[model samples]
Target: MATLNKGILGGFSGKVGTVVGANWRGLDIIRSRPKNAKRNPTEKQLEQQMKFKLAVSFLQPLKTIQSMYFGSGSGVKSRVNMAVSYTINEAIQVVVGLPELIYNKVLITRGELTSFQNAVLTTQPGGVLHLEWEDNSTQGNAAPADLVSIVCYCEELKNWEIFEGIVMRSDLMADVTLPAYCLGKTMEVYAFLNNVKQTAASTSFYLGQHLVN
Candidate 1:
């Protein structure tokens, strides 16, 4: 790699013949194109690719939820990108040489707002999702008025039900009714808390997956 002592296009950006031209630091430069290797990927690379695929496929349906609950990323990265990276690195596992998602290790959101305590979920008839959590509003940056969010995913259908329940942190229990279409589908449920201002949210809690009645 070399610097281009000219404009961005002075050295060109594509390959011509055996050489590649590009601009760097306001300078035009020329370099030879490296030969391509037909070698197979290393074991580590294969594992990384598998984990990335798992994370992406599992998270794609929740892009809107991630954008709202995930971290506020920096520079060119958005919240969804950060969420995917986190899932790839932290929530994926190698079981019997196959990549699998460790659902409990996944975080839908992470922030200073205190997370739910002893959170639990129950599936009721008619897509009614009963969520119960001990109030932790006295801890960290949590507040009694903090809003709660429920993120439900149906793996078989690759569908999502993002519900901003009207319950607050002070509410020890709340029932969220999913759409009629989700009544019989198995859903992975997670809950989190966000400040009333919607400026911050707590780490999400995985309440386990169940067949919605």
Candidate 2:
């Protein structure tokens, strides 16, 4: 399978904090042409006419963490966690600023959930973020109904209401999406802000999958 590396490059090295998302790939469908049609349809044609099926494969959006600390001392005790407020189902384009957010060091890649599982991104710290499942067992698929959450702390814990808790499903993935049209062309991707800071040149936000008919 082909994969795209979305990691932060070299220009922006110090600002990027963390990232998490899935690498989903499914079979693409193709329509039967009239030239292939026949009066006496064979069993294969009959099957295709009845139902459409395709093999879909994808790596579950694994979790990841990358931290840039204040001091660089060997074995300095520092903890960082990501309080994710959103889930990404599609692509997001961020206009990163200079000095604070160096675009070069940042890269967007898939989160690796297991060892055998292939990952898209290179983690800076160590292993992937270990999220304790609500079910206790570490094996099997995570319940689709449950919300994925994380918490990141550097020095002190501030009162962050929006940072923690179930990021309401509505707040992340949408059931229906309106077409994005501009200059007589249609776009499939949608970009929005989950968290915003107007005063700073640097900030963090969340992104997720979008729906469109």
User: lDDT of each model, Cα atoms only?
Assistant: 0.83, 0.22
Residue 75 displacement (Å), model 2: 7.2
Candidate 1 similarity to native, TM-score: 0.74
lDDT per residue for candidate 2 within 113-180, as digits (tens), equals 21111111111222222222123113332223323233221111211111222332123332221222
Among all windows of 10 consecutive residues in model 2, the one with the lowest summed lDDT is 53-62
Instruction: At residue 66, give the lDDT of candidate 1.
Output: 74
Instruction: Flag regions of model 1 displaced more than 4 Å.
Output: 1-16, 19-35, 72-78
Number of the top-ranking candidate, with lDDT as the measure: 1
The positional error of residue 21 in candidate 2, measured at the CA in angstroms, is 67
